[model samples]
Target chain A: MQHMTIRKSLIWLGGLMILAFLLYTLLDVSGTDLTPQDRINTFSTRFLGIFIEAVPFLLLGSLVSGLIEVYVSKDDLLKLLPKNPILATAGGAVMGFAFPVCECGVVPVTRRLFTKGLPMSVGIAFLLAAPVMNPIVFVSTFIAFGWGEIIVLRFVMTIVVAVSVGLIFAYLARPHETLLPVSFAPVRGGNWGIQPLPPQKMTLIGGLYRAGRIASDEFFEMGRFLIIGSLLAAWMQTRISQQSLLDIGSGAFVSVLVMQGLAFLLSLCSTVDSFVALSFLNTFSTGSLVAFLTFGPMVDIKSAMMFAGVFKKKVVVYLIVLPFLMTLLIGIWVNIWMMR
Target chain B: MNITKIPAKDAIKIMILFGMSGYLAYTILSENLGNYINNSRFVWLTWVAVGLFFVLGVVNVLPFLRPKADATVLLIETSSIMPKSWIVMFICALPLLLGVLIPSQPLDVKSLTGTLSTTVSVSNTTVITRDPLKRNILDWLRAFSLEADKTAFDGTQAQFSGFIYRNPEFPDGVFMVGRFVVACCTADADPIGLPVYAPQADDLAEGQWVEVRGTFLAGEFRRAITPILQVEMIEPIEQPKNSYLYP
Candidate 1:
């Protein structure tokens, strides 16, 4: 039954990938009247630039994830967290303020932290806050804008949302019963006989070997999703008409939805997303653009999938919903504050 | 049964990742290492990372190369499977269709061209097109002029086009105020000053866009010594297609 399930899933996934490709192609080809050569030039040049920008971050993120899987032990993690969920969530947000991790790097580390016995709420909070609350982000924005008020307002609003959403979910969640089934069985070495044994603790000199093993496994499972997601994002960005998006984002209700949806779909890092959001300054409300920056990296399609892989469906649902709501509130707050 | 088989895939993937990581680290190191090494040229490390990622992406497809079982397993029967070729074709074609063959309004090209042609004013001379040599000399002079906070026009000329927003003191002259070009939004926008004095300045109001041909003169206005332009001619031009640089 398990074997059948795996096969079915594989076939379904393959089919879905094809479907995504066709949809992307149709969207892309339908919009442009460019000749074939022009299309090719556009693809090669644009994709090359994107690859140059994106590949380094992806490689670094994956390597860090590999290191965590191989070197970080689960038992060491549980000792650091508070038993109480509220404190744990708050602690996680505070931790984000110190660690300068972007969203891409946060997912694997968050998953590792979860296995290490950190409460799911705490892990989720760290995931949400780490991308935005970190000092690098704040300092960069301050340098870019040269205004303390904008930086301070963005920081305070983000933290309030992060902590509140995390606490709300923590209160609602039933961790032991609700946690999703993660099919992670650590690899074992020295295979000899018919009996299947549990993963063994290898020597520290075997660090490279262990890291290699973890890296390869993760590279296969996660790498496929990364490439496909990136390609999809690249395609959508190229094909979609920004006129409609700009029009929609100009309004309060539509702006929140479009901003949240685009945040998930684009999968851009926090550092660069701000620049992209800047183009929208004249088109959308300052509040909506704030929502775009604040809400995007915290919860997106890629992050949602990562969360679904580690956390229960209910938890993932809450994580998505909570960010949307909080971003709306933040948007509203910025609007009122600026108006005042 | 196939311990070596598993290790083979693992080893190939490892080598690729390692090569990439090593290359990136080396590149970053080399950027700082140039003082010690005393070499201006070396193979860039980013290329190595690029190569490894490309190789790893290909290696990832190797696992699916195994022959499929003809018979049913786990009480599930399948008569036909989609060809792997079709899947691969679709996957490869995906990026091109979505990324390249799409219509986006050309905004950058228009604004950059407009910015270049716009003129500035200098004393008694219509600097329709600036000599590159003179502009270079003016840049050096601009620093000293800015530090001293004096508004004076040097003989070098520039073509500047902007709205003539006049201050109470410069009602006869023109305070050429323009919106700043920020990477993404107006939050980062800074207003730049390009002062000019033209006969048309009296007709131009706070937001009326005008083109001024002039040369920089050293002088003081308000508190700062600015590089002021002597206007040769002034006129209005329509706003360019893209109000914002990038969307």
Candidate 2:
């Protein structure tokens, strides 16, 4: 029986290898207009370099995700927030500001927090708010937007989207049932599974180390995603023509949608997307630009995957849907206000 | 009904190899194609990194899917991850890709008139010029309160280029409004305004791109202001194509 299983696994792996080889060949031909095996080594090396650079970071995120699975208890987290929906959501946004990590860094941490027993509302808020509303992100935005009437508006809009999403999800669904934590972390049931009743038994140092381990693991595991996301961003910058986007700069709403679309597709890093958006400054209105900033980091391809890994499929759907609408509304408001 | 999984370690070994293979494939593809596409040396390495990620992804899933295998073989495969030939290949290709992508910062031209072909020739000249000191003055204003130095001019040579911005406070004259220069993005964007000292203010209209080759005449009124230019020529150039310098 085991032999048969081995054979099938081998076959599965072999198929993957064949697929990789064929895809490589197809891409080689289609991309460079090159014949078979002409510059395959060169192409492979370039691709490998990107992966190598990203591995360290990916390992970090994964380890962090793993630790959170091991150490944090979810029950303790639920006690922090009120059952009331509005207060809970607002509390989530406030907690998001406490962490200074970017969206990439936030992924594992968030999953760990959710696993540890944080309420669904708070977890959702951390996911959305940490990327944009955290102190580090806020300072970056302040510097980027320039201190104008729009500065306050950007902050308010980000908080609104993050809090509203968290609150809506909290009332709509509970964390345990909604985010599919069951598959990832199967905690033992009963009192033994729970840390001893007296929480103060552990020293501060011990708790700090545990927290550090969890954070680092999260960093390593998700590092690859960041690397991949950044590379895709660079590719978009090089391959995708900006002129096409430039053509639709006439209408405010159309322009906002297009720019937001570009943000989603481009998936540029938060550190760099500001500059890219600024490049479009003369091309699009401020409102559209705001939409691009708010939407990109919140729901890029990678963050979406993280959501899938941690939350329930239903919650993931809402997580994606709500912020998108909120961003559009904010964009329109900014446009109308700017005109006035 | 009974498919075996590879041992966790062996699966990891395969993933590492797959990652390497993906890297090899990407490099070959890019070297031939990247140059023709608008390639940057800074980002050329990015493709290779991407390819490596495929290998990492392969490794990442190995433990989950690998059929349970023996410990000895897994150890051998793990050691094989680093061999002499692989290292040599990586070193040889990196510099070649970098050579093609770096040292060129291409400007994106938005105006029909502004777009210049990569083939456009620029002759190096010894002429010393700056965007304008008025821009510097405006930057100072942004940092500190705006103190209109009606008497701030010293008749010193100041270079400037920008659209004309009329200040309602000083309707008698106009200020040369230019966006501040930042290497990366608007996060660092600063604004600067230069004092216009031309005789016929109406001749140089707003939004007309021009190179001002005159000296600053520090004075409050246009009547007292003087602009000395050994070369006072106004030629219409293309509007600034890139709205922000580094977005």
Candidate 3:
């Protein structure tokens, strides 16, 4: 009863907050002159642009997650994955070649996999590597940079970062510590028995029907986060100038830090970020450009929000901080090494 | 077995999803998707999303109509609506609603100025063609960035179309004509332009689309050695169907 009361009050508070925001925006729109109106238009356009660009990917992710939930059995998943944690982590890193999903799509899919008895380390590895290690991103990088050492370096560095993060999770964090507390335990009720449905006996038509249902459920669950994440990202993109960061950071270390910071804030997709990074090659150091590509797909403002939906708050913090530090170290090292 | 009625809350949620998907589809069908996403390539992705949304909506609504169907077919279990979920649903729907009610317009010049810095960087690898008349604002910006001596571009004929922009610092009879070049989407778009000098420059208001036939001459703007477009023929033109230039 107390819990219900708290929830009710929270809802009312949310309602009031939203009402205030709407009223404020309306007043601002009506009260402002042309300049403020233009600002509003630009903000909305960017917000919607990020939202529209991400919707398809989010839909694809939910569909794939739905299919996994309905069709793939725990016994089957266990049978397919290696028993050794290190080998499993390595397997997760390269798995993206077969399943190419952007950062937005990877989160739901990773969450689904984690809940399905997959090892936490393996899940972490897959989440980090899949966005960059995939074929589509590889092809795009090749197209952007052509045949070169930078492409090779990017591939190597991504695998190294993913594997390292995976190993760190495996060695340090307990399996239970990595996942969210809610819904991690399997439910042992309902007519479907211990299993949702008899794994082998489930009909194709029934599986697809179930898949549709699961997709819709997952879409709403994840879609809300996507919207909020994209809104924040779009807001930052509109208000901040990339050149300001560039101007301040001159040395190799500062430049890498600045670039990684930009990468997190910009929240660009892995497949196309190479082209955007390419434009910076003239102005930014090579190491900084590399950091932008490496750190972005693994962690960003959008992905961090999505991660909060799946992992505990502490785990999400580690996920963000660890990658930033690791990527920065690698970036600075590369910068110094290349200078010789 | 009787058809299971979809709870009112669930029904509302489904309709909202449908409305959002429909708006996106409408935008694509109308070729105004570019107004939101600068990339033309994403149109097909929007089409796919539309199909998926329709499927999900139908699947969700079916359980209410089919009396004999198993109740488990409904993906979301009908439960009392949580306030948190309601807030999230509202957040999800807010953008789609605003997108529909508000008329679609290009990003204004104010946003362009806010996002771009005072100095723009151009790549040295930018290929400069022999005929400069075909070069756009981006092409000239690139040339200016890479050129060792700005005076080399003097007497070069140039023609391009872009919207007008002027900073208070810009001298009278001089204004910038620029376009936003999008690498992936509008979020990553960068404003690139060249300073144009004409007797009537001050007469043209900002954000007015214009076609300028001019000669590129090395000149100073904002105390920096930048190439200035010496306008020969200037005419007001309608904004391009797609205001953004895709790289």
lDDT of 1 by residue, B1-247 (tens): 2211333433444444554455434434544212111112222424545554554444343333333331112002211121223334344343334333443222221111112111211222213243523432223233333343443336756665544455556545546545333232221122334556676557665555666667668666555555667777777876433322211
Question: What DockQ, between 0 and 1, does each candidate earn?
Answer: 0.06, 0.04, 0.48
List ranges where model 1 is wrong by over 4 Å: A1-32, A36-52, A97-99, A175-180, A183-204, A249-258, A281-283, A311-315, B1-247
- TM-score of each candidate structure, all chains considered together: 0.58, 0.53, 0.90
Real contacts retained, model 2: 0.00
Top candidate when judged by DockQ against the true structure: 3
**For residues A1-340, could you state the per-residue lDDT of candidate 3 as single tens digits?**
9999999999989978975775455335443235556666777888788778878888888888878877676688888889899999998998788778899899888877776777878889999999899998999998888777678878888888998899999999976677764325542222111136556766787678777776776777778888878877776766567667667875889989998988888788888898888878777777888889999999988889888888888999988998889889989988999888
Off by over 4 Å in 3: A1-35, A187-195, B1-4, B68-84, B113-131
Scored by lDDT, the top model is 3
Best-first order by DockQ: 3, 1, 2
lDDT values, one for every candidate: 0.51, 0.50, 0.77
Better of 1 and 3 by lDDT: 3
For candidate 2, write residues A236-286 as lDDT tens digits.
333344456556664767877887777675554454456556545555788
Error in Å for residue B195 of model 3: 0.7
lDDT by residue for model 2 (B1-247), tens: 2234555543543444354445434544544322212123224434544444453454334333444453333323232221224333333333334434432111111111111111111112212233444433323222222223533444555554554444445444344434333333211222334455454555665546555656544444334432222224345456543322211
Docking quality tier of model 2 = incorrect
